[model samples]
Target: MGKKRVIQQTEEELIQETTEIEQKLQGDVKVAKSGLREGRIYIKSTYNNTIMTLTDDKGNTIAWVSAGKIGFKGTKKGTPFAASKVAEALSAAIEKVKVSKVMIYVQGVGTGRDTALRTLAAKNIDIIGIKDITPIRHGGCRPPKVRRV
Candidate 1:
């Protein structure tokens, strides 16, 4: 291994980067304010990770967060705790954008779904409704093949 190297950004570059980030954030807030106070939140909890997405009523995505992106590693990302944390962070983003009412659609067959929903409910935002959108096999899988002779 070699010595650690640090990349430095000039003052103007740093300022530009900050401005770009702020502009993006401003764009989110504007979308939230576009004649609809209600936003949609989709929480997908898979066995490996939990992901939450915030979208406008027209299905345009405003932002999204995931458990792994929150610094949890390996199997921990699938834990209920990580899901709740993801929910917490998403709720904060909702608050930032002043989304007063949220309609939640939860999917996936993971342990984090319920906990994440509970965490979102515990927040100050007003929940319009909660719906489970996970798909189910209508009549279960096809019967197994006949046992070998």
Candidate 2:
């Protein structure tokens, strides 16, 4: 029988690999810095679900929450109640950053749209302004062909 092959890792190599993995895990946990006052909250609502992202003035994402992220599944994730819950959770996260005021940009036409905003207001987060930025098309695409006889 051939001699068994054995691969051994040195102590330095083992420590280096473990440190790399620890750094990667630390990167996954976001730590907010102090003095983040005003920011933007973008709400994208659809028939299926609602997503909320909180970002800084320069558009760096600070925190985000969605209906699906809150353990809601399927059609229930699109409901107003789910949206409100998502907002509630996201507000708690943003509060840790000491966000005093916010400008909200709402996009899409969904039942959860108003509910999410109401939840944020209930948290007393000082909504500075709300804007509906839903896009309107100019009708550029051609019409579909008629059905065959």
Top model number, TM-score: 2
Q: Report residue 139 deviation for candidate 1 (angstroms).
A: 3.7
For model 2 the local lDDT of residue 79 reads 94
Worst 10 residues of 2 by lDDT: 22-31
lDDT of 2 by residue, 10-121 (tens): 9998788556533432332243554798999999999999999989999888888787766666898899988887787778777778889999999999999999999898
Please list the C-alpha lDDT of all candidates, in the order they appear.
0.82, 0.82
Error of 2 at 4 (Å): 63
**Every model's TM-score:** 0.73, 0.75
In model 1, how many backbone clashes occur?
0
* Root-mean-square deviation of candidate 1: 8.5
Checking candidate 2 for backbone clashes, the offending pairs are none
